[model samples]
Target: MTLSFFQKFWSVLANDIMAVISSFFHLGQLLTAINHTFISLIPKIPNPSLVSHYRPISLCNTLYKQILDNVMIAHDYLHFLNGKHKGNNRLMAIKLDMSKAYDKIE
Candidate 1:
């Protein structure tokens, strides 16, 4: 059965399982930078000229993130909410310290 344009879009977004997070370029484009995030240098202190006094701000597309975020929120709520995991034996989590991680990388 053939699906309409809106129907296809709805299905794609509603059932987005995050299988493919990739993007491609169209004709005549040498490179496609759709996932390129906007980086901004933000000052940590009031005012300073030192490079170490600033932090990098990453701004990316939120449209796709919201889809994954909704799924994660639901999963976490079911696993951690009030009395949700009372009988669970163990809890597992991974924490990554991103603070100052990009300072010397650049």
Candidate 2:
């Protein structure tokens, strides 16, 4: 049976929608299966292996230094806010004006 143009179009659209819905359902089932598998495996495993094996001592030291510096800066800012640098009234009145707010003249 030959389908009219509109009928063919509707049929194609319906098929595409069904395909998307089926794939979405399949994805949900896949996620559920994965969760179940992980849950079942957790208790049976004696030792869990760490997948991320990159451990650099020098990198760690650098990160520690950066964290320390940031903490010190934050502490200094807190101290300043709490009247530690209240005598520097000139620094407080310094106005910073953005040249181009949002317009780029160039």
Candidate 3:
């Protein structure tokens, strides 16, 4: 079913899920499945040899996707503002992937 359908018909279920997510976050608990991901390498050229010739992408799960959707809204607004800036003003937005950094911390 579409997102709109879910929101219209299963609003309570949606709200409950959000509440659960909020509670889990407040308690500093995260599900292992949310951290689990599969990395796939796709070749950029037909005859690829070195790792640089391929691009590695992670196939993330639903909860991660939901988090990204919210984050991307902010990014979208930053992109729009950067595009609309006039005169000598320059707007810069930076995106950093800190997941690997988090994994290394004890």
Candidate 4:
């Protein structure tokens, strides 16, 4: 096995991530530092010109991502938002959590 495989299988990383995720549920808290993500824009094809031709992806630490994914799965937010509505009019819903919005300002 490679070093990375050994590290992942034997290290305390899994425990640490579970602890963080547990705190998120029991205490309703998340680390502010982990919320910051680096967004990178990659071109879909060579010699692309338009903004739509680029795909944007968020990059974060693997541990942070795993915790976030767990939380999302528990909440099932995407499943609710993606459900079809039977109507001629468009249905829309917006969720805004501004608990620490001001802290994001420079």
Task: For residues 4-106, write the lDDT of model 2, one tens digit per residue.
Answer: 4325677666776467557768875322331221111222234546533322211122212344576698677666766745555523332344454432222
Clash list (residue pairs), candidate 3? none
Off by over 4 Å in 2: 1-65, 84-106
- After TM-score superposition, the amount by which residue 85's alpha carbon in candidate 3 deviates from its true location, in angstroms, is 17
Q: Return the top candidate by lDDT.
A: 3
Off by over 4 Å in 4: 1-10, 39-58, 64-106
**Clashing residue pairs, backbone N/CA/C < 3 A, model 2:** none
Q: How many residue pairs of model 4 clash at the backbone?
A: 0
Q: What are the RMSDs of all candidates, in order?
A: 11.6, 22.3, 10.1, 11.5
Model 4 lDDT per residue over 1-106, tens place = 2336536685656787678879999999998876777877878899989999888765665555565566677468656656745676555656666545422211
Query: For candidate 3, lDDT tens digit of each residue in 20-87?
Result: 68978898886677667778787879999999997776666645566668779988888798787788
Best by TM-score: 3
* Alpha carbon lDDT at 63, candidate 3: 58
lDDT of every model, 2 decimals = 0.54, 0.43, 0.70, 0.65
The digit string of per-residue lDDT tens for model 1 on 37-101 reads 77778888998689989888666544433556766886886567545445756555555555545
Instruction: Give the winner by TM-score: 1 or 3.
Output: 3
The order of the candidates by lDDT, greatest first, is 3, 4, 1, 2
- Count of backbone clashes for each model? 0, 0, 0, 0
